[model samples]
Target: MSGQATVLVVDDEIRSLESLKRVLSEEFEVICAKDAGEARRVLESEIVHAILCDQRMQHETGVDFLKHVREVWPDPVRMIISGYSDSEDIIAGINEAGIYQYIAKPWHPDKLLDSVRGAVQLFRLQKETETAGIDMKLTPERVKRVVTEKRGAAQQLFDFDRIVHAPDSPLRDVIELGRRAADFDISVLITGESGTGKELLARAIHYGSSRSAKAFVVENCGALPDELLESELFGCKKGAFTGAYQDRIGLFEVADGGTIFLDEIGETSPAFQVKLLRVLQESEIRPLGAQRVRKVDVRVVAATNRDLEAEVRAGRFRRDLYYRLAAFPLHMPALRERPMDIPLIARRVLDEVSKAYGRAVHGIAPDALSRMQCYDWPGNVRELQNEIQRMVVLADNGQLEDRDLSPRIRSSGAPITLRNGHGNGHHNGHGNGHSVGATLKTQIEALERLMITEALDRHGGNISRVAGELGLSRVGLRNKLGRYDLRKGVSRDG
Candidate 1:
């Protein structure tokens, strides 16, 4: 009856029951039951939105109890929590009990909370559709209209306009391309360095597409081993392997009508690439233990920082898989490549961090902003966000000053001052106004030469260190050094 969704936590162990309750009590009306009988009684008396049950119980297994619940009152979303070793029983229970999700042992509080939230959303969506007389018989147009109505808020939140960039920012072209890509149902490969907001762009594409109403799932492929990664994306049944206890739905299945963003796809092994290539090529996937393949209508949006084309040439990656994923490739410009956008991004990040931490910081000082734009952010947008957050925390006054910036960023680049006059500005502590009548290309070359020389001196002429600092390959750096005629004093050591 309360506004908050009610969740039933059923665990034979009192400690676990209490822990589950504690984790969810802040957001939901959490009710605890020691066993199946107590859970049944509570479910009959209260309106439960979701059920979190422990698989192993003293009297009856959680599966049996949930199966009974499905027969009697099946509206609540059901999830089972068990150790990795309970795969066989859990797999059988999945279909028989209509289990929505399986929580592995030692669940993270945040992840558990996210799962519960998703279940509650599903519950509410189901109820809404039923009440609106929207069923399987509805036409595609009708379904799209209703779903779009329900998901309008999310669409607005992730609209293409939400991506912050200056008018002349290099990212503008990429965003436009991404927006155009969103209109079609095609696989997208977003290539960029880490923290360059590849996932953010992926979200924008998904929300902008016709599949906005469905689930937009994400998985970091590099975080898990080949076996686990395969299981996570392609699903796995009980008895698939050692410790396989429950039937798990893959991210592909979950994002059936929407998009699945696979981050760090380049880190997958060649063997795994073959499997992924099959899924993309055929639009179907076979679970680890299942005999039949299931067709999926999910759009795949994969991202990586690695040069996958180079990897293919080096025989470290499959050329076939690379082609499949890069059907609509979009490259994200690194932070240094889009220096004009830094001031805007920094201001936005400052506001977000200040509000998140309840700080009184109002703005970044002009000098601090200039220094930020001058420094080459090797870590890209993610690094900029972290820097802003730190400055907001350490700031004493209303503004973030240059003193609050990290020492490396503060000392990395020469001071940059933009003037409204037609004459170009001076740099490198030089009084000669060589930039006054220099062409754009000449000015760019001058800046590059200065950066490379400074980096070489600061890094003690180490080629590798200077190359990394400037976001260039060793060979590319060497070529630049040769062009600038500065390789004479540089060390050859890698």
Candidate 2:
């Protein structure tokens, strides 16, 4: 927790190494070495925030040694110092070591100090990010779905019909899960916050499944009154009710040989739920004033923002209907969780809005993206799409910045912690104090951990790629990761 940083300098020449120690000792805990072997021994003693090493060492190269550090350490940034004019090998080493930046021979004290300082700061931030990951109860897959979706269908939000997304996005997963439900002719309950695209997902599933060729219909259970809802879902014969002019086909009959989406299913009254249960139980819709029951092959997909389980436990929704309708369940991740996909979402939403407005805008700027990423999109992707639409029309140019975002979603405050429980900040245990710096440090460590683990996972634990993506020296990334005791399978986002 000390502001003081410890830096290790490795070089073959004793005089030059001493010179660096003298220059750096004023602001840091300087550990000097004449070779990589001695440097290794010192590294074993205590955590070194940054490493300043010469390109050429006795019998070993600095780049090669730093590569070792990248694998073993994952935080401390690596900087290579060289007197030689030829930087070809040094350049190659830069990519390999994940070296932060290079210091040419005859370096300035200010430059050297600045470089080392930046590296240390980056190290602290990255380490803080890594350490913060332990409290994230959300798994990697969930995290990816929450913050890092890649559905091609979703990328084009121009029209609901042509939603393209990569398989990785939750949109596709939801569709796939719903499609599977369609094939079995079982009921499906889709639950998520408002504007979470539950109905859209249902449509996608219905159209993609085995019942694609059949009629697919939708009815909002909450939009109509109890009597209207009942009549809408089940047909009525002529003179069945005061308003009945002739025999009417309800959604079930209309959706015969296909699927019916019951949006806001939880909004239905208990009596209505009982009526639904009967339909499920008997597979027949009893039209009012009809002599006989009519059988239907309509598949049902129900959606609601409310927790039907708790509702059933309460006196509200019926337990029988809840059990029957929830033959398959799928929960959509909120947008606050998946900030990584903001850029993609924003770009796509802008394009759709542009087409609608009959204007073409290229893209969003970095500043706008900064705000987008920082905001805790409580309403999820739906909210983001709306904001982008407002910005597209409101802003004069394509360079939408902080002001372009809706006032509520405007990024002015600190990043909101959607993560429930534990200390929102300050990993000094939990719920003690919300020390901004401490919590920020903790958050950075969590990010560091996630990035390191992801890089490692993608690279099959190869130190090179992990370091490269993390902007750490191979040695630094490995070092930080080792300090945290993360090895084997990673626990990033998870």
Candidate 3:
């Protein structure tokens, strides 16, 4: 048998404690504690590497004891277990006790053993960091290395420079805002369509932030059930609920000294929103079944496709949480609104997809690019990426031709005139399905409407600024607005 580290297991029930001891005894030295008091006594004497404490006890809760442990004897990797999935207790343990993992009741022996072994490894790494003169319990460099290694080449490519955009692209302003926000430790909310690279911007913000060297964990609130999502974000203890067989480390804990990107924050239920509000307000988390909350220094960067202000007014979202998340807000413009960026982004995607698929694709044809720029990209950047990859995979010649693009893009509308070196490719001059060319007047009005809408979205519905940018008098702009039926398009508050 290997000379393994000592593990302290605390539980009020003798049967369960004995079962845990039996499962772990062969691998390591097992110390048993019947209650928090007993656990305290064991901890005082033993040089244990990890502690597995029960959340529910007669005298002291697991989180309460662990919080005390964090103060006096903080070296051991702390974990909690409980029968109930109480979110308040769970959040408390995360914020106060600094639990390593929260395991639910009726844990599988193998998984529990694996968790203890992992905790031992964490304890060793932490000790090494301390011995190497690092003051923090968790080494930022070490954590960064692990995250980078796990994420591989993809994460490395998400830095600020990778956010490709043309010089006049509206995304440039958003990117600049994000970079500036990264310098400060503040909550940032990125609002955009699903495929508009909100997560990409979030990653860039994280990597550019002061906390870049620590973990940058991500959680999708919309992807999981409320109970599961709560447990995932805050963590759950053993016996916290059925199927919670092992202690789990939450994204909040993993990103304690770094950032936690919460995607689709608007999709979370109102009840879950309240819990999230508590965390943002207190800057702490309580693991499921925990007795006290644990403090965390994690910066939050939330992203959503929904209009949270609308949600808040509809009573579907909590106002306080919305305000907390949007302390700094960044919006990504849609792909259709930034047509000039399409060619550049498409070329970038082509290069990436070519390498990924081992294709010998050179670049995109001008005609194809012109076609792409004409189509209104409802799916935004994500759709474009998929289209580019599809073209790369099917390209017969060195370059992707017009025929290589999807039928949706090819059959959409008349190709826009390319500003760069691309030649003027004329469509049948039909508007939307009309084989007849659009009258010169119809064409001008369409172009005018497009420009006005872009300005409104960019300037947050500032009519005066829109008029100035379009080189029109306020009355002229107002006349155009009336002609185009655009008066209701922007709110007066902007």
Candidate 4:
């Protein structure tokens, strides 16, 4: 203790106390205590630099004992070790007892030693700061300003503007709704096809909210079994099940003051839905093999590609859970549904993939882009990204051309051609068609007009329905109707 930092290890179990001591004895002066009472006596006599206390004991909880220690001996860095990962207790220990770190049970000796060493270093830094009068130089206003600046940076990173889409994208309405919902403390359910960026929207909502300073955790609920999912979201005590050797903090607890994005939420079974519903309704979770329930303040943003309403009607999903999760629902349109956005998305992907692969490809040819827009991307944005990555890897020139596209995309539609005004070639091998001398812009306008006319006729001249089907706003569709001179037969009724 004369030269090395002194650490105090407290546990009721004799073997655990000895194990912790043995791990630290080589690097520091280690002291052991059987319980809180003995620990208080040691603290009163020894110059302890750090204290590692077991959370559970025969008489009192580690949190309660540490809270008392904080009042009496406030200098030493405090840490809690336990076989149970109860988030509520951990949070309480951190807030009330000023805990520095949490060591899970069955922790590796190297990790344990590292944690203790870090704690010792922190203790020394604090002592040096006090000795140099550095703590006195910091004011509350300075601290508040630093915190505010950090939060502002996070908000900017996850702002709604960060979401990639064209001006006329169908995602505009959904993004507007999400921006509004972010200011409120309510659950949101985002519905979309896979790879439509549901998790990205969820993140924007979280960081744009008041809870931006806190954690934002994500979990794909469809990837795990019922038991494992439960343990992941609600935590578990050591020995709760096979291989649960250490207490682990759950995502909900980790995101206590922030948001949790549960992707593919519709894949959860009815049994798991019941448990999740209970947690949502009560704002609490009970760790597996634990008798106590912990309260959490977490905002949930769930996403799924499935039609949950149909699932409920078919008795595959719970109606209550559906309603709970859909407090504010949003839908992300598929890539094919918003064809006008293809060029922008494709260019963005091209730039990203080119840089990642160290390629010189900086642009997509107009012909290749037109073909991509014609093909319906059933796999959505993710599929488009993969296609771009593949093309970048195989590209032979500075630009991505039609031949660089995958066979499926290249053959998806006819190549857009610019014929000479003198009709050097026929359009589509037909003799001297109207499009023979058409410019690229003229051909694009003709295609747009044809699509709008077909959509209007298909929806029985209902302007609103046609607009929605064409992924356009009502005003935009009206403008298109007027441009194509097809408004004469269109009805204003939605």
lDDT of 1 at 161: 93
Give residue 7's lDDT in candidate 1 (0 to 100): 87
Model 4, residue 97: distance off in Å is 18
Candidate 3: regions farther than 4 A off: 1-156, 416-494
lDDT of 4 by residue, 1-494 (tens): 11356688999999999899999998877889999999987765445668999999999999999999988778678999999999999999989998989899988999999999888766644433342244543333454454456557767877899787766678888999999999999999999999888988998999989888765778899999998898889877656788776454467765667788999999999999999999999888777865556667889999999999999999999999999999999999988777666666787788888888888887766556656766677899999999999889878878777788888775555544443212232345555433433345545654665566557667889987887777899898876665444565597575
By lDDT, rank the candidates, best first.
Answer: 1, 4, 3, 2
Q: Per-residue lDDT tens digits of candidate 3, residues 1-494? A: 11256688998889989998999997877889898888876654445668999999888899999999888777778989888899998999989999888888879888988888888767645543432245644443574454446444544678878998866678999999988998999999999998999999998888887777666778889999887997788766555677776444456765667788999999999999989999988877776765445566789999999999999999999999999999999999998777767767887788888998999997766557656766778999999999988898889989999888888777776544322212333566633422123344333434555567667767887778888887989888876666444566566853
Estimate, for each residue in 301-384, the C-alpha lDDT of model 1 and write its tens digit: 999999999999999999988888899999999987877677678877888899999999987665576567667789999999
Q: Would you list the clashing residue pairs of candidate 4? A: none
CA deviation > 4 Å runs, candidate 2? 1-176, 411-494
lDDT of 4 at 54: 98
Model 4 lDDT-worst window of ten: 418-427
Residue 32 local lDDT, model 4: 90
Model 3 TM-score (2 dp): 0.62
Q: Estimate each model's TM-score.
A: 0.60, 0.52, 0.62, 0.62
* Model 2 C-alpha lDDT per residue in residues 155-187, reported as the tens digit of each score: 233233455343244565665565566567677
- If both were scored by lDDT, which would come out higher, candidate 1 or candidate 4? 1
